[model samples]
Target chain A: MSINEIQDSIIEDFSMYEDWADKYEFIIELGKELPAMNELYKIEENLIKGCQSRVWLHAHEEEGVLKFQADSDAIITKGIIGLLIKVFSGHTAQEIANTDIYFLKEIGLQEHLSPTRANGLVSMVKQIKNYAIAFNLKS
Target chain B: MGAITTGLNVQAIREDFPILKTLVHNKPLVYFDNAASTQKPKIVLDTEYHYYSSQYANIHRGVHYLSQIGTELYEKTRHIVKDFIGANSEREIIFTKGTTNSINLLAYSWSSAFLKPGDEILITGMEHHSNIVPWQLACQRHGATLKVVPLQEDGSINIDEVKNMISEKTRLFSFTYVSNALGTINPVKEMTAIAHQAGAHVLIDAAQAIQHIAINVQELNCDFLAFSGHKIYGPTGTGILYGKEALLDAMPPFEGGGDMIKDVKFEQTSFNELPFKFEAGTPNIAGTIALGTAIEYVEKIGLDNIFAYEEELLKYGTEQLQQINGLTIYGNSIHKSSVLSFLLDGAHPYDVGVILDHLGIAIRTGHHCTQPIMDYFCIPGTCRASIAFYNTKEEIDLLVTGIQRASKMLL
Candidate 1:
């Protein structure tokens, strides 16, 4: 599926929930189902230090496609990372760099990406984009 | 239900703060972040509005009628703050931006006037960054050494350590009256006495204590005390740095500006007298006047009554939170204020904070600018629910429910 298509499906799935609690429960489930990153990858270099939580993001390229793995001590941030990986992981670096992600606002979780929120989700997205740009330059 | 408990009409008090009626995400707002800042009462808001609308002018330098009124109201706040903290005289109260500004002013002025090479400035491990950073900068500027009194397992400072640390070289012993991260209320009087015996001047960071505890600088015999106005339901950009007349007289001016000078010749300048000497530049006139109104409002209710009611709320909150399984509370000192810092077994504080935010509960997460406390505890941070007198038992019950729901969702 395309990045926009996945974001649309996720937004549609979120629209079914009428309450904030229900939406959060869905996010919690996503967080729990996310594949755990390797312990070796969770090093100081991959760490994104935020005021409220810690996040680790690792990226690599498979053929021409960019793959990403990330985790956060915060479950909400982790679930949001899961959503980001779903949208950006399978795409080529060039395609990932050009894609404009707006699904967070539609799902009422845009606050998590605000710089003031300081949960590392903003940096996480920025790191993904930077990774994509670096890989694009190499290619 | 409107109820009166512990001689404080908390229901009416809650009504005075209009924000308490606000709804967050379709639920009633439950504000438990009093330690960060308190919600303003209607009177404080109205006073600020009224000042801006009716009586607004630059103070002290104006001979006009409006300026006179503004000056009177602004200086009235200085007197009120002097009385509020039980300082010796109104001249002892020097208005700064806030607690941080007050501390920085003291650190710069006092260290320049007193500190020598190899002199020591003592602080604690549990101090807010405001209290710690300023002294560090002072020590750096003056070639002085900074010392810290470590925290015990229960988050309280050891008196023996304080005794051992203070020596003839200890120039200033500064510490917080209450820990903002952990709610440990230190023995300020005893500590002040200990520092005095070593001929070290004591500066109390009452930013966390001024609202919850009754303070008397003369009785405590501390040379300097600092507190922010906003923390005590007053306006931001308004605070007091109460210093003994002799000490304030001995120190140099912090900032060289318009109002701080007596006469600026081409080659030389004479400084102004106490209070105005330290208060450089144009001050926050409207905010200062409104701060007086806030102090009057608190005085009308009485700090003793507010303290009593809040203590009950703290006890109730501690008891209720203690019942939750897999939860651990920090700062188990016998003397505590209305702050509860805790962590769940397997959930991060940020995760729990987000879940609680959805439930219309406002809590503080993270190290609360006291990273040393977090390092000592070997945790990233804890979710803190600090209370005010306006908060009720019902609100606490809602908080407990929200925390339990968060634990169920996150853990």
Candidate 2:
């Protein structure tokens, strides 16, 4: 789904819930359903350091589309990875590079991440975007 | 969940802590972050006030009435801590800034006197950086070698690996008695014995283990034991270092200042006795007195009962968290302390932590100051909810309810 569609669904779902707990559980469950990409991406170049769980990513521009694959030992981290790919995957390299992930704020999901986890997610997303920039520069 | 005698009234015991009654966003504080530091009871708080209010004076120096009272309270705390840990002598218990400073002092002074070229100092992979880094500095400064005992896949240190790591050149072996991140309770008594057989001094960092566990330094035969008072419901900025009196006397003073010197002359200087030799300058007098009351508060509640209560809470917490479709607990041990680390299947730990906070459940989020453990697991961090004797199962239920609710929003 588009980020706008995801935002609308979350707002509608959140409106249906009375308290923070219900809304939180819904987001976490939604994270669980986020699918890992079908292809493997376990190369050395795309690994994240300082995480307690293993997370690996690979992104490339195929015919100007920003294609990405990722995996992690932690299930939730993988779901978070899937969330990132959702925002960037299938987009043009330049578009992927320019998109402001601050849209995470619009969906109201950014505040819940702890400083380190939030920082790690940002690094992961930044790395993908950097790869897009480098690919654009290379082409 | 084993058969153990119950009914010490933990709920009644928890009532003594006023902070538990405190409100955060109109919700009663459900504190699960005891591993970071525990909430203080009235007695511990009031003890500090009592010192500053009625009897504020410099200890071991002042000669008047208020000074005598301050000295009495401070020295009395020394004896209380000695008995609390079943140490052989009050002289053996030297108050320091807390566990980190204590370890640094031990490594610095002891290695300066004894360590030499090719000597090996062994420690575990599961140690807090405080434990690991001190040895690294000591070994580097003193021409000693640093070696680490490997961690098992379950996060416990393999004793056989420790034995294998030991050599004739081994001068010291230090390990954390309870892992700050993993919550696995190590067999420090047995490990100390093994290190002794290898002809090495063993230092046990009890920073995370001492509050709920009963520690008898004499029985363990550990050469040194360190713990921070803050972890045990006392004020911060105070720590304990229990060294064998003979060893403490033989080692040089860590820092020289007033009260640490017997008599200083322009020509020559002499150091004070065992503890005073190590404790430099005016100490954390208020912190020391407050720590005594914290120990007293724990004694009143009972350590065995506290241990039993926390184990039940951990079991319940583990079970409830596992009931969620894909939440994973890091340390799943039969013999463990209070803290439990885990991650929900579809969210960042920070994200989960933030959601928990929005619901008014507090937990420690991130690497927990043990970056090595996080690196070992290959994740950035996990959310840790460390229970204390005063923490209730009802609080654990609230934690579960919060996490289960947060799970919906993250996934």
Q: Which segments of candidate 1 are over 4 A away from where they belong?
A: B1-5
Per-residue lDDT tens digits for candidate 2, residues A17-127, read: 666556555555555676554444676667765344556777776776878877664555555566667667877777767766654565456742344553446567778
Model 1 whole-model lDDT (C-alpha atoms): 0.92
| lDDT against the true structure, each candidate | 0.92, 0.81
Per-residue lDDT tens digits for candidate 2, residues B205-280, read 9999899798899999999999999999999999999999988887988887898999899998998987788988
Interface RMSD values, listed in order for every candidate: 0.8, 5.0
Residue B163 of model 1 has an lDDT of 97
| Tens-digit lDDT track of model 1 for A115-139 | 9999998898999999999999988
Write down the C-alpha DockQ for each prediction.
Answer: 0.87, 0.21
Q: What would the per-residue lDDT of candidate 1 be over residues B1-411, giving only the tens digit for each residue?
A: 334368998878888999999999788999999999988999999998998899888889799988999999999998888888888888899999999999999999999899999999999989999999999998999899999999999989999999999999999999999999999999999999999999999999999898898888999999999999899998899988999999999999999999999999989999999989998899988888888888889899998998999998999999989998889999999999989999989999998998888888999999999999999999999999999998988988998888889888887
Candidate 1 clashes between residue pairs 3 or more apart in a chain or in different chains: none
Error in Å for residue A127 of model 1:
1.3
